[model samples]
Target chain A: MADFFQSLLGNVTNVTWQMAVMWAIGALLIYLAIKKDMEPSLLLPMGFGAILVNLPVGSEALAPIKTLFDAGIENELFPLLLFIGIGAMCDFGPLLNDPKLMLFGAAAQFGIFFTLSMASVFGFSLRDAASIAVIGAADGPTSIVVAQQLRSGYLGAIMVAAYSYMALVPIVQPPVIRLLTTKKERLIRMPYEQKNVSKTTRILFPIIVTMVVGIIAPGAVALIGFLMFGNLLRECGVLDSLSETAQKVLANLITLFLGLTIAWRMQAAAFLSPQTLLILLLGLIAFVFDTAGGVIFAKAINLFAKKKINPMIGACGISAFPMSSRVVHKMGLKEDPQNFLLMHTVGVNVSGQIASVIAGGLILSFFAGLV
Target chain B: MKKKIFAVLAALLILLTPLCALADNPDAVETCPPMVQSQLEAAEGSITENAEIPEAPEAAEPVSEEEGASETSPAKGDQALSFGESLGYMLKGMAGIFLVTAIIILAVVLLEKIGGKKKDGQA
Candidate 1:
């Protein structure tokens, strides 16, 4: 009877305070996911994975999660898979209507590089610095791929930073946007000029972008190619079912796997540290700078343009999808009821998706060349 | 013809000298410098001695490396960059990404122009 009890409670006996603390974190994440509905798809799996790994075991040999991480995250197959879904869901028509919005996408990525240098100042290694900096991309897959590629050893912290910052975009962006721009600047009204994008152009845009970006930044070919392929599936018209499957089934499966596998590195021994705090703090800084970079760049363009551009459109340039764009649109309305910046913000938001993938590839190739 | 014969003879002598030295000194290859020969001999001796040693019972090297990396703290030998150098990298990286973005924007503009022309003609 005693032997049976001992075997049953063996893992319990091995529990440490760190493991207990990690469980509480996992519970908190679960609560947020369920209650706040804050990125439930990602946080739920991540929270569960954290608890699973932190369970006190007689040995450090976590089996399936570790195995999945080695096969998926380490090999970078999951993020690439997720990109297909992201690409399929992306509507580049708005961007096509206003091609200049793509520039804001580029401007927003300034925070990533800026954060890289800042991370190094805080005593992170080159690999860790680069990984932490990618949280500025406001892109989950990009953050995972870069951190994994660099072997940053802080994937758990980095992933949490990227996703949490992404979830908090509605709250985090407004203050930064308001702080940078005046109520007058925020109210600058630009008329919505909708252009009829041709069917052929819609199809060709993905192809041309894939070819051009792939040629210029070969390292990002998988990410760009898969994303473009997904977009192609959507734009082609005949592949509706396949596109839907890619957008829904493929993306969800990979996101679940990506989240859980990420917890392989979240063992309490690795996750409970001061560096994690620094990473979270740095992530917030990067997000602020990203917003500032876009807004400032937009303000700069107003100098050359005959008609002033809405500087809030710049904040939409980060790859938080409809969320960042929606925040900008709401702020525009709050400032002046007549202002309509949804289409404009959406255009810049979609462009940010493309720009971030290109940036990720460039950072990888650049650092690889540097080392 | 005499000049060609003299040139051929000189080439033959240059190539054969090293072969002759090797044949004379069987202990060492003529091409190997003294330092290289000593190092090679030492390596060969060590290899023979190590072949007898049972691989040092698979030391704790891998374990130590894994623990060091997996720990939340800095790895054992990890080094941080100076602020100036980090800033330099950040600027260079920013410049490269922006350049790529510029190229993408240019491509989009050119594509739109051409595609627009085609659509206009079709209309």
Candidate 2:
């Protein structure tokens, strides 16, 4: 009887302060997910997985999760597959209607390169610095792929920073946008001119994008190819059911597993470090600069453009998707209730998605051989 | 319609030529400088040695440049480039992104014209 009791209590004594801290962090993430609705699909699983992995159990207990991580994340399969769904869900009509908005997407990527220099200055190795800088992509899959490809030591921190900042787009973007633009600039509204984009154009957009991106940055072919493929599935006119499954079922399934598997790196020993905190701070700086870059680019364009663009719409040119667009749209509505910037912001937002992937590819091309 | 198709095909062919060349001769791809390669090899060796003997969690602190200096080559530490070099890369990367964006925008504009023409013909 005593032996049985001892056996039951044996693991309890093994719990350390770090494990307790991880548990708290996990619980906090769960709270944020449920209460704040901050990327609940991902954060909740990541939170629960953090707790599950941080338990004082033996290595055998974590074998399954380790297997899943190795199979899904380490091999870079999940993120690519997730891209298919993302591509399927996207409606590029807004962007097609106004292709010039793509420049905002391009300009917004300035943060990634800026952060790369900053990370390098801060004494991180090139591969690790590049990986950390990709957090500015405001993209989870890109961050994961870059970190994995570069063999960055801070994969766990990078993933956490990327997703967390992506979720915090609503909170992170506004101040930076406001700081850069005046109230008058924010109020400057350009009327939306809806252009009829034909069926052939819709189908060809993905194909042309894939080819162009592939030709320019061969390293990004896989990432861009998979993304455009998903878009192709959506725009093909005959693959309606497949497109739906890709957007809903496949994306959800991968996200659920991706979130949980990410916690394998969130082990107390790996995650609890000074570097993790630095990574988070750097991630925030990246987001700030990305917002600044987009707003400044817009302000510059307004110098020559006959019709002024509401600078806030430029801030939507990060890969946080509809969230970044909605934030800018809401801010526009707040400034002038009659002003609706959703279409414009959505155009820039989708363009940002493509731009972020291209940025990721460029980073890989430039640094893959070096590190 | 034939002209538009020919234009697209020609553009695709032009774009595809380089990829085909690169695939045919992978050795043509650029590699790291010899100095950087040597440094990376040394760093990898040290990392492998460390992996042989697992340390306690407390030892898992961030590897400072000074700490890694012993394993790194004398010319440059574990960093692939200095701050100055990274700035150069930044300029190049930003230029590359803008260039690609410009090309894509041009392509979209051309496609829109073609699509519009087709729709008008159908009507």
Candidate 3:
């Protein structure tokens, strides 16, 4: 009986403030993911990862799980392979249907460049600054790639900021959407016309994007090429089984590893640092500035147009998917019930998927050369 | 080649100019040489440096294979260039990515405009 008590006390010796903080963080992730339904797959695994990594140095509980993260995530291969599933699952139909939405994609990226400079001024190096800026793109893959390439000291903080902001798109973007546009502007209803992209165009797109973006941003080929390849499988019609696996099983598997591995980087010595707090602060700023850039750009374009585009949808350009679009849609409903920007906003949101990858390539090329 | 270089410069202009202008003491900043490789290495430990610039194979070929993968890969590393000058090369690498995007976006916009105009004319 005494031996059992002593062993339990020995186990409890590992409990430091750092461990407590990490446990709190893990619990927070669980609350947010489960109760709030924010990026459930990502947050749930991340919570589990945090628990496993911080489990008071116990035996038989965490060895294999930690090993899984250590082997794949540290090598940077997991995130890259995850791209194949992300690529394949993406339905470029909305984007291709309204190719003009690609401008919004470019518009969304303004935050990345904007945040890069701001982060630099805040005392981060160019590479860390660049990685932080990618959070504005609201793309987990792009953020992971940029952070991985830069090997930012605050990788955990940056990852958390990127993923959390993505899940909070509905909350974060709505305020910005409301601030940027007037109720009158939100009332601008767009006519929805779904264009049927031909089989040839669908089949050729991934190939063309892979070649074009790959040659230009060779650093991004691993990510964009796989993404486009996934789309290729999706559109090929003959590869339905492959596409299904890419979208469901492969993506699900990779997402788990990615989330947990990121949590492993959340060790106390790293997590409690001031730099992490700064990274999170900069990340939020990126999202805000991105929304501002997209809105201002659209409003400027609308000045030239006889029929103005709904400026609220421009916020959706930041690629939070249904969340960003929903924010725009909700704002629109507030202004006028008949006004619906869901499809248009979704169009731009999808374009953001492509744009963030392009931005990642651009940043990689720039700083990789600098280093 | 010249046009391509100019285009890279143009893209860099769009991305970097705003921040450069925001630096309060431009003259003071201009006076300093670029953040050299050594300084960056020193800072990496003290403040966590992120200066590693992955070099493209073609440009990186002249360096020893070790440095081809790491820092000191740029040709003018031994020389003291200005901040903008060193950053210019890094921006070029980044420009390589944006250049493709800009060209694609511009092309699609142009085509859409032309097609819309033609439709209006027919109407």
lDDT of 3 by residue, A1-371 (tens): 99999976877877888889888988899899999998988888787777668767764676676686667665667877788887787777777677667667767777777677667667676566777778877888778777877666677888888889888777777788778888778778888887545566667767777877776667678888878888899999999999999989998888877888788777776788888888888888888877886787789879976768988777777877667877878888778888877788888887777777877777776555444
How do the residues B1-123 of candidate 3 rate in per-residue lDDT, one tens digit apiece?
A: 435534654674565332222121123223445573244235322111112222223644555575557644434222223343334333333333345555554444344455556766978
Q: Individual DockQ of the candidates?
A: 0.19, 0.31, 0.11
User: After best superposition, candidate 1 residue A309: deviation in angstroms?
Assistant: 0.8
lDDT of each: 0.79, 0.84, 0.70
Where is model 3 more than 4 Å wrong at Cα? A1-4, A58-66, B1-99, B105-123
What residue pairs are clashing in model 3? Answer: A87-A227, A88-A230, A366-B94, A367-B53, A368-B53, A368-B54, A371-B52, A371-B53, B44-B49
lDDT of 1 by residue, A1-371 (tens): 99999888866778899999899988888887899988888988899988999987643467877789889988988988999999999999999887778879988988887888789889898788888998999998888888877778899999988988898999999998999898889889999898777777789888888887776667678888998999999999999999999999999889888888888888899999999999999999999999999999999989977789989999998999988999999999999999999999999999888888877876676454323
Q: What is the DockQ of candidate 3?
A: 0.11
**Candidate 3 CAPRI category:** incorrect
Number of the top-ranking candidate, with DockQ as the measure: 2
- lDDT per residue for candidate 2 within A137-197, as digits (tens), equals 9989889998899888888889888888889999999999989999999898779999899
Steric collisions counted per model: 0, 0, 9
